[model samples]
Target: MSKRKKSTTAFKKANKFIPGGVNSPARAFSAVEMDPIFIEKGEGAYLYDIDGNQYLEYVNSWGPMILGYNPPQVIEELEKQLQLGTSFGAPTEVETEIAELITEFYPAVDKVRMVNSGTEATMSAIRLARGYTGRDKIVKLEGCYHGHGDSLLVDAGSGLATLGIKGSPGVTENTARETIVAPYNDQKAVAEIFNKYGSEIAGIILEPVTGNMGVIAPQRGYLEFLREITYKNGSLLIFDEVMTGFRLSRGGAQELYAIEPDLSTFGKIIGGGMPVGAYAGKKEIMDYVAPLGPVYQAGTLSGNPMAMQAGLTTLKALKKEDVYLELEKKGQKLEAGIKKNIEELNFPAYFNRVGSMFTLFFTDKEVQNYQDVKECDLDLFAAYFKEMINQGIYLPPSQFEANFISLALTDSDLDKTITANYKALNKLKAEL
Candidate 1:
């Protein structure tokens, strides 16, 4: 590993023009108590910082690079599309092909409307729900981030938690009032809210397995309970799978849990590395979204050929069933290694993992919500992150975020990461 070098200069320069020096808030690195490392490029499971230090990547572009960065198949497809053209602001045959591919994996998505980002998909979905049901209020979990759309950003987590913002500045109290926040894993809270405002609630949205709050799994029966309550209350259900989709399975969290949401939003791998998002559901509900129905949403860059090709190629490469099995194995190995370390070191910490996503919290308490996450030792985590970075292991900058495993992470990569983690944990203990 090379010595730490100055690489945040560009970001510092960018801050003068861009808010917080980042187009996305999490990249600001305020949560980790360090300046953000400007990445020169990434290949597979490695990220090369602008300073020329290479580290085993665990962020995976905040959970999209499942096939790993710049897969050859996806690159080739993008090149092919670049030759043809980029955006037409009209329609292309590839759009329907991708739509068909999506519905095949997710039969619940009989019809889909592609958008440019998860925010757009979610925003459009919420609007469609209100239009179809003619209701106003929407319910969301306190720590599940659905993106930056004014409506769905009500009870967001991730960057919001990192930045310590109570909520966005522009959101009016009147708009905030339209969104009802409920605790995750609490069916009673959900049921009570639906009971109290059943008629007024247009929809309920959540991440099926929340990666935002350190990979919190849905409590057993939590998803079923929500589905039952939403149906009984005549409220639509929206699964914000921007993080969980494609990564969890080809069908996303819905397929894993076997729960069918009335509406679902997707991002990340769907666009490969480009900006893309999509929302799809039963034909009846989807038919309510645009030209066919009154709920209007449009984007000039929606269904851009380049983004489509990248997503399609990436999805096709992931079609090999072994990829997920490999991810599960790698995920389990990493979790087991951390568990062993915890036992040996007797650190006051516990781990939560589901599939290829995991988080190590510096606390003994079971982490089921954002409140539990608030109790972790941030000082220990900060020291641990520095140590890990020094050891050429790249982890998420915040304790509240989960680590991602990609197909490119071989057994050796897992071994290196585990060893580095052990050293980091010991170093943190010494520091304390």
Candidate 2:
């Protein structure tokens, strides 16, 4: 086992003040049957834990470090902005600059409003949808997590799936009723829900390409089917692109799939790893937000100058033609390596990949939905996770979470990761 004495001590101390010794429940490592490692710092493609162990990071701060940690350009921009000030609680030119950049990239977004996190982005988008449609209920996929917002917390994947909780404790039954849950990639289930509650539904929200349920992609024409149904129903189609935006492509899944949503939520790479998020769409719907329309949603830290500077720098860097192509090459390389290992080991594992996000499920069956993901062998994944960490690769602690790839990782780093994966799987097989 790796020497995690300092991490262990830090975790113990942290629990006295911070619940579960972590700010996010996903970081608690409860699903992996281990204590969380305390990170001291991160650099390009690697994290240094408090124990002084270096790990090739696959989590990438849960998908925002697309250019990897502390990219010189982003940091330089942030430093320059820091001298100016942090939060204005008002507005800045940088916000307009970033907003214009976002609208330029995403064809679906005619206008956008910034928020502090993915949760706020998703929550605000849903509210806007409801207000625009004059409906109260929303439809969400069973395992497609938007965030921790009360309306979205039901049947959420990611940390909720990791911890085996269906819905949170505090959400009222009435609130749960308003948010309908349907199986992902199941057009029939969605159709059935809409048929029953079509008039009441404000919108249908989903991860365009699911990362929360471990990188499941939409089935053929699945997105088109959704677009058709929502249009027919006179309801809004909301794409919770918090994970997919800018990561999938410059225009995100909407551009990749050639389907436009009425409203879309974005985070992660949009903020360049800073705490920022946004909801945007056609002017008709976005105009429903206050200061323009009747719906009221505001944030004290929305479009903070520091986050705007970092995001602007990151987005500008992403505009380069070769960035995503290079990412695709790296993703394909890593996917190929993992698939080769799985085949050689004859392990009952399946891999899913889209652009730079991927996941390895401990199941022989092809995963298409939450029920399919539930069939994965959690025990095997836990063993593999422990072995990988021991081999100096840091992955997401939960089997249900997607691992991200960053531009900072070299071919050598990928090779090392593949080698570590091979050894880890081999060790697990030997133990069995």
Candidate 3:
């Protein structure tokens, strides 16, 4: 096994200062029942832990590094901007440039506001929606995590699910009541909620293609159903594309699915692996945000030069004709290889993939929603995760999280991963 002595020590040291030894709960590896690895550095598709062991990374920094870590072009642009300055807390031309690029790709967005993280984008978007619609309550899909904002913490997925918390303790019951929860992919449940509280609901927010609950794709006609219901109820439809933006396609799931939401939130690949996010929509509705209308959302570092430059560089790179095609090719190869291993081993597992994002759920039945995902054999997944890590393949620690593929991975890397997967499956079989 690769030595993790340094990582273990670092975790101990971090715990003295940082809560649970992680800035984010997802990084704690709590779901896998292990200490988090301290990454020393990442190059291309590989991560070198503090102990010097190298891993073929599938986490891709939780779905940002789509072109892989520190791509030369993005780094060069960021360096040029860093020499200029980091944060200005004022307007910069680059912000407008990136915004233009975003609006161009996502035609549904005629205007956008940048933020420091996905949470801010989603939170701000909801506020804008309520302001525009002049309504109070909002409907959110269960297990489709938007962020940790008080109104969104109810029945969330991701770290909350990983740590076995139903909902946060501090979130007020009143806030929870304002935020209606419904199962993902269950249009009937959404419709029923709308029927009961149509006028009260400000909007409905969901991950167009869910990544929080192991990359569940919306069922056929589900998006259309949501669009119709929201329109009929005179409520806006919000697509939280924090995980799917740019990574799934140049225009994200909205483009691939050809569904236009009233508002959309973006992060991950948009920042080029930096801390950045955005909320955007039709010009008429976005006008409801601060300065233009009454809703107030402001961040000093919302449009930092470095982040804007990095995002612009990444978006330009992705705009290349063959980028998404290449990603789709790589995704297919990886999926086919894993499917082959599952067939050969007769493993009771379900693999779900959408473009370069995927998940391997340790269950025999198809996973259509969070409830289905919960039925997965998490113990088996924990064991499988351990074996994969032992073989120098790094995956997302939580069974409920999705794995991302990057352009940095090579055919050779895919082969090694397939080999490791086979070996891991055999080991699991042997142990059982």
Worst 10 residues of 1 by lDDT: 1-10
lDDT for each residue of candidate 2 in 1-432, tens digit (9 for 90 to 100) = 458999899999999999889999999999889999999999999999988899999998999999999999999998998898888788789889999999999888999899999999999999988889899999999999999999999999999999999999899989988999999999999999999988898999999899998999999999999999999999999999999999989999999899999999999898998999999999988898999899999988899888889989999999998999999999999999999999999988999999999999999999999999999999999999998999899999998999999999999999999999999998888887
Off by over 4 Å in 2: none
How well is each residue in 1-432 modelled by candidate 1, as lDDT tens digits?
665456667777888998988888878777778888888899998999888899898998988789888888888888888988888888998888888888888867899899999889888999999999999999999888888888767767888887777689899888989999998998889888888999999999999999877899998899999999899888998998888888888888899999999999998888888889999999999999779999999999999999989888888888886888888999999999989988898788889988888999999889998788888888788888888988998989988787899999989999998898888888776766
User: Which residue runs of candidate 1 sit more than 4 Å off their true CA positions?
Assistant: none
- lDDT, residue 284, candidate 2: 86
For residues 1-432, could you state the per-residue lDDT of candidate 3 as single tens digits? 568999999999999999999999999988888999999999999999989999999999998899888799999998898888888888999999999999999989999999999999999999998889899999999999999999998888899999988889899898888999999999889989988999898999999999998989999999999999999999999999999999899999999999999999999888998999999999999988889889999888898888888889999999999999999999999999999999999988899999999999999899999999999999999999999999999999999899999999999999999999999998897777
Candidate 3: segments with Cα more than 4 A from true spot: none
All candidates' TM-scores? Answer: 0.98, 0.99, 0.99
